[model samples]
Target: GRLVEWGGTRQIIKEPRQEYTNALVSVHEIEHQEQKPGTTPFLSVKNITAAYGRSHVKVLKNVSVDIYPGQTLAVVGESGSGKSTLARAITGLLPPEEGTVTFDGRPLANRLADRPKEDLRQLQMIYQMADVAMNPRQTVGTIIGRPLEFYFGLRGRQRDARVAELLDKIEMGKGFIDRYPAELSGGQKQRVCIARSLAAKPKLIICDEVTSALDPLVANGILKLLLELQKEENVAYLFITHDLATVKSIADSIAVMYRGEVVRYGAKSQVLAPPFDAYTDLLLSSVPEMEIGWLEKAIKGRRMASAGN
Candidate 1:
């Protein structure tokens, strides 16, 4: 017979039957309470200027961003806009020439070898091409089990069970465990990659166009699965994609990049609203609208707008 205050309203705390629900609510509230003080960013890239060679043709130009806990920051840009470069920098594949990357308040090491394995485990990347990212010769079990074995030191039946658990988490059943990469379809292959990324139990996952290769329906299913995993795991995602439709569905915040610069960055609702940036307008207009002849209209409108400017 206890009264509980929830959202400014008082309700009677019911019997022990409702304990599970009450416990969940309490946990949710505790998370909010823990977040009330707000720690420093989980990952921070500060004014990073990177290049491929000594001539220093800058691929990323003073680029800065943040990845916080339990949120998806979708980075959108056309090809050659430095999106993948940014991801590589975050994962320690490339070193910045001008700035620093800090993970959980410590500066990221300049080389992958210099980074501690535990630090590497906190940040994981899911590549666009599943075929290239995964080992074609390896079975799904071996592919997914490698991370668990490497990071957690599990092997034999333990590793296999963990792989099976990861597969189930990604909506793939246990039957596919023994299958090879060539045996599965594109979507299933990507799901296997997802399982591998999840195997590390990473705090942050950089999904570099993870769903782009699949058909729309299959991609949607993958996105839904990602949302479910985020809910259960508290995983943060740096989702890099050119697909505005996907961004609208999954992004909490969006950063629109063009020619290695952030043209626009804000909450999804704010950035997608009217008074859009010229590039953002062009990007939004390019999405296949339900109305017929939308592409032509968008193109003509952009041309006219450009002429006026």
Candidate 2:
């Protein structure tokens, strides 16, 4: 046995005997287990241009972006500015009319039928309206368990256990397992939707205004939970929202869209700072501030400028 000093104090301890040494070896092996490097850009959009019809009302114009591991890229813009269209394009709900979307180094084909199940599993989406996204007839367990079963082949007790784990991860108790979506509140429903997306173990998730409908306090809680989950799971997020407040809280980078084009794209600090583009400045100024007279002053200024023009 060898003597070991205890902290900075004078106390000493004897080194492990054979049994103690063996236990320590086992503990070290368990603690040092190799972890796989986190997933990289599961989805990539390169110079993508999407349109609706022959007249070709373009919703995305030469848009290019990458979603890397454990990062949130917030796409912010005014209404009809093509934020949701960009999300749909990434998820393959709408194929790009021009350019390419690559997943895991492979370009996505023209049709969903050409895409593999693994590719589908690697990408999932959490839509804005929880009530509309969820089925009223199904119980919470069924809604959350379906993706686990589809992607992981989990069934019976294994599936149920996974669902419970997900619920716990989303900060919901097991008591809601048997309840239907109709029984839960807006925030809880959204949480269940999030758990369902996580069930597939996706590398990237498209969150389309997932917090806009909720109250401020509830939205903040959801944003905090999402940030925690990003840290733990190493999942990339394409957070599409009109709310700049939400972007400030969770976005690592910002892509400012205007009329279907990426006008400004960069790190949060750089894009949100002074010397912003005129549109970006307008968007930033629109966010409600704590000061009482800001809105009135902004409106008056806009009116004066319009009259001058």
Candidate 3:
């Protein structure tokens, strides 16, 4: 593919001189009001350091972040930047070599199996691939109802009722109850995954690139649904993504990670405002704008900065 134009996303959309690029950037944008963070963070990951088993290499370097109740704290970075590793650490999939994860005023166990049943129930996770996350043999009802049954011991009609309610909550309605994963669209399957997480009535949901795999329109719908659910359920989110656009749409706070280190962290407005850290600036500048000579201009500016330095 030929590179035509590149700069910030808004610039790319509004000022594209290339017809090809203009056509590409034309899509609906999601508007979100930045929410204020509460005084107390319900989930605190303090100075976490982790590494793979049998390896001396540290993948996470003193990383830490606080997620307020009912808000979204997005951990953003490109691949191999420890975004997912941080998620793994918090979920106890990979226990940290150092530091602590505190939830709801109590310290959490370092490993998933060691955590109490209540801890597992209250801290839920939604992975990127909805298709693989659910079992193909299970009906949508069964997938969503399993959590309700597991967490609250709801069975039979009660579980089914709760499943239908959750389906409604995800805006999928109750019609999908009988469908299998293979029968559903990508977005629909993700919605079902979301409903399953909500079925547990979690206080915090770790959304690891939940919208990155879907079409833009479909992803926006999911983001809207998530925002709506957060409002209604008051469930906080640790939203992990590499997409800055997605971060702008949903994050109340942000933690910018690079090579296992948190380079920047704060409220959405502060973190995104001017005087950005080097990596954050690079990430923001790479958003691909629609200007006629935006790419050339950006390149020139970067070169000039490099020369001056």
Mark the regions of model 3 whose C-alpha exceeds 4 Å error after superposition: 1-28, 290-293
* C-alpha lDDT (0 to 100) for residue 203 of candidate 1: 92
TM-scores, all candidates, are 0.85, 0.84, 0.90
Summarize candidate 1's per-residue lDDT along 1-309 as a digit string, tens digits. 664333311232232235544553332121111111135668888888889887888889988888778778889988999999889888878887888998878898977889999988888888889999998999999999999999999999999888888888988888999999999999899889888888999999999999888876667777878877888998989999999888887787788888888888877777889998878887888877544456789889888988999
Whole-model Cα lDDT of every candidate shown, in order: 0.82, 0.83, 0.90
The model with the greater TM-score, 1 or 3, is 3
Question: What C-alpha lDDT does candidate 3 achieve relative to the native structure?
Answer: 0.90
What range of 10 consecutive residues in model 1 has the weakest lDDT sum?
Answer: 28-37
Candidate 2: residue pairs that collide:
none
lDDT of 2 by residue, 1-309 (tens): 684323321111124345643342222121111123235555678999999878989999999887777788899999999999998777777888898988778887755667889988888899999999998999999999999889889999999999999999999978899999889988999999999999999888899999999976667668878888988998888999998877887887789999999999877878888998889988998987544467799899889878997
Where does candidate 1 stray beyond 4 Å?
Answer: 1-39
Q: Clashing residue pairs, candidate 1?
A: none
Prediction 1 global C-alpha lDDT: 0.82
Better of 2 and 3 by TM-score: 3
**What clash pairs does model 3 have?**
7-288, 7-289, 11-290, 12-289, 12-290, 16-290
> What RMSD, rounded to one decimal, does every model reach?
11.6, 14.1, 4.8
